[model samples]
Target: MKTEQLINALVADIGPRRSFLRSFVYATASGVAFDAVVFFAAIGPRPDIAAAAETWRFLFKFVVTLALAVPATTLAYRLAAPAMWRRCRFEVLMVPLCLLLAATAFELDLVPPSLWMVRLVGSNSVNCMTLIPVLALAPLTCFLILLRSGASCDPGLTGAVAGLAAGAIAATFYALNCFDDSPLFVITWYPIAMSTTAAGGYYGGRRFLTW
Candidate 1:
């Protein structure tokens, strides 16, 4: 109850909080690094990545993916804490949603109607859907395991968010090798891939995170 005792107690509480956060960071980094190694070793970046980088559409992929990753990761981390979970602003997700929508519209307007379906389908639709989730597996596993240490009110939702974050992170790397840069392709297939991961997360969370 004394001032010194109260300060010491607060510091003690902060120590574990900081440690948990650090662990989350380390888990994420390690998961991503593992994914990167697998990606480069097996599927490496597109040979023409330098030329691809010159295009706005190609660069925008990173923008949209990173946008999604940042907010989803933050929400997942916040959800790990019982008190902070309620305060997390889900609206941050709108940034990536808006960006994808605007780009899709522009792509639709710029291309011919006949080409719309082609762009949406892309050459790698199947691969896009398959690989993103595959790449996300490591990160999603790491996130779900990390979440176990926290007290989340809605385990399924927290897991879903972690899956979304993992998917986004995977997509960012996948973009480097993806030849399809059209927003139409991105809008259509990327969600399917990421949603697959999110679905997995939901199931995992419900199965594991529950007290």
Candidate 2:
């Protein structure tokens, strides 16, 4: 079969059920990576995740970061799959749900758009705004890739795992874009970015999770 045909078929298989899962995973994983930009940036190169646990403020944000996932996921679930909400999986819900959190975080002034840009050298953040593009770009691409590849994971676990991976990718890109090279910058500004990604994930989840 032609690759294009294969992808179209895969999209069909993903159907409504898998579509929601894929979006959720991609968005959520991006959240963690975005959160880490500041986490590691504040600590600078070679941050000891264990040793860096002393500061109460940073720690609070860390907890809040994960904690925010729940409400964010819930919000996405409400918006996307309110009727058949139980059909939504955590991992699948992770992407858009976290994306929503990122959006909210940005609006709330939680994190930078991504890596800080000294002179706007091609950078971006994860948030509601980003979700718009994801809606346009990610699904079709992801669906096609999954289709051509002819690989599938359990929507529940696969989506969650994928989300964490995607979140990390987002974080890496974010750090690169903002690369301010300052402990203060990470500590002070990183959370905002994290929040933005979280919001995007959440909002996406809200709309996508509408099973």
Candidate 3:
């Protein structure tokens, strides 16, 4: 059967909209909860969290991450249904992108040029890259399973969005533990980690989401 026909049939038989929404909520919540458990157990928040919270750089991490997370999650959920996928606007992601860019610019203007490389290659670059994806694994799996249940016309794209959401979620948690608060480090390293997860999602979508 053609992909459109399959999507139509899946939509017809996919039950009520509420069911999908409920499942989406549950799946995301459960996945985030699991990631949180792993974070607390393996690597709790930084010891200086209280003091760090006062700093604009530290607080801005959550601002950017959660900004990315909210829209990415919304887009991922919308993409689960092939009927709604096309209507989902990916431009929403630009909010976070612009925010990061602005912050990076501000950082560059405020900090000396000599320290640019130092801030960009923060002390925990290796750990930040490693842990974001590790933390995202559960959420990515949950999102892929959820996406599979619905019929996405563009499974690879849907999976990529799911991975983005999962990566953002993981990054939010990891931000608490990460000592690197510079927007320079975040812009440089966070994308590398999330892109890694998104690539995994794209490959998984191609392999499993096909009829």
How good is model 2 by TM-score? 0.30
Candidate 3 lDDT, 3-97, residue by residue in tens: 99999988877666779989999999989999989999999999999999999999999999999999999998898787776678889898988
Q: What is the C-alpha local distance difference test score of each model? A: 0.93, 0.39, 0.90
TM-score pick, better of 2 and 3: 3
How high a TM-score does candidate 3 get?
A: 0.92
Weakest lDDT window of 10 consecutive positions for candidate 3: 202-211
Tens-place lDDT per residue, model 2, 1-211, is 9999999998886596566667555654444444455445643322343544454433443343344345444333333333444554555435434543554455346437564343122222333134322322332234223322222222332333323333334433333333232333333344444444444433443333323
Winner by lDDT between candidate 3 and candidate 1: 1
State how far residue 134 of model 2 sits from its true place (Å): 12
Give the poorly placed runs of model 1, Cα more than 4 Å off.
none
Best-to-worst ranking by TM-score: 1, 3, 2
**Candidate 2's error at 96, in angstroms?**
19
Higher-scoring candidate on lDDT, 1 or 2: 1
The alpha-carbon deviation from the true structure for residue 75 of candidate 3, after best TM-score superposition, in angstroms, is 1.0
lDDT of model 3 at residue 147? 72
lDDT of 1 by residue, 1-211 (tens): 9999999999999999999989999999988999999899999999999999999999999999999998999899999888786679999988998999999999989999999999988899888989999999999999999999998899999999999999999999899999999999999999999999999999999988887
Q: Candidate 1: lDDT of 173?
A: 89
Q: What is the lDDT of residue 46 in candidate 1?
A: 95
